[model samples]
Target: MYNPNELLTRFRKYLQAEQLAKSTVEQYCCMTKYFLNYHKCGADRISTSQIISYLVTISSPVSRKQARAAIAKLYFMLGNHQKMNKVPAHVGFYAG
Candidate 1:
């Protein structure tokens, strides 16, 4: 029952319902899809550590931060409140 495409559609609707700006909605959706593809697993199965591990691989600070934000929002929309709460708004990208 872990259909990435279906979850993605719901996520898009959630973002629009939340009244996110069009560009923000697009960015979030794109990042969410990328995350889904990268993990290749159900969103419910993605762990907090997995998310952090992915973020660590992004070389650009801006991109890493954006992806983190997107992941957090996506997790929240997916009802993973614990993981969403754990995703810091500003992860120390400088800290290796």
Candidate 2:
């Protein structure tokens, strides 16, 4: 498994390569790090269900949306298109 710091660095590069706004990149990276720490596992070991569960824990709608987008982007960076597709589309809906 790749080191979490290395993975986060690559993820930052990936977001930059996509030309995302500076704040968006920062927010995504921050949220991704929180998710990684919360799970205490490598990015590859994170399941879609785990992602949803984490998002659900965020009580604020905006924060939950941001977290969902962040995790989706992380999965995209990891080349896990299937898992990316499984992420919830909106903060109001749960991935059931």
Candidate 3:
């Protein structure tokens, strides 16, 4: 699992490395931070239930899609070294 700071740092590197647009990077960064704080858990200790809750907070499918894309971005980071994807367990399972 990624800690909040690590997530931010990695996203920063991804933004620069991938040459993502600033606004796009900012949105992903914000989503990453929101997930970190939403769980009330440490960056390293965030749990599946908390992740589900955060996904549930999305009001629309389009919004959820964007959120999932953000997660996939982090997943790429998590998976760089043959690591597992970082997307939470509730991905594609959240009903709302």
Among all candidates shown, the one with the greatest lDDT:
2
Q: What would the TM-scores of all predictions be?
A: 0.63, 0.66, 0.57
Candidate with top TM-score is 2
For model 1, residues 1-96, the per-residue Cα lDDT tens digits are 347777778888998999989987877777766666656543434555566557546423436567777787776765556745343333211201
Q: After superposition, how far is residue 1 of candidate 2 from its true place, in Å?
A: 0.4
Instruction: Arrange candidates, best lDDT first.
Output: 2, 1, 3
Model 2, 1-96: lDDT tens digits are 556687789899999999999988987887766666655533434556666567557523436567777787887666666645343332121111
Q: Model 3 scores what on Cα lDDT?
A: 0.58
By lDDT, is 2 or 3 better?
A: 2
Backbone Cα, N, C clashes tallied per candidate: 0, 0, 1
Q: How accurate is candidate 1 locally (lDDT)?
A: 0.63
Clashing pairs in 2: none
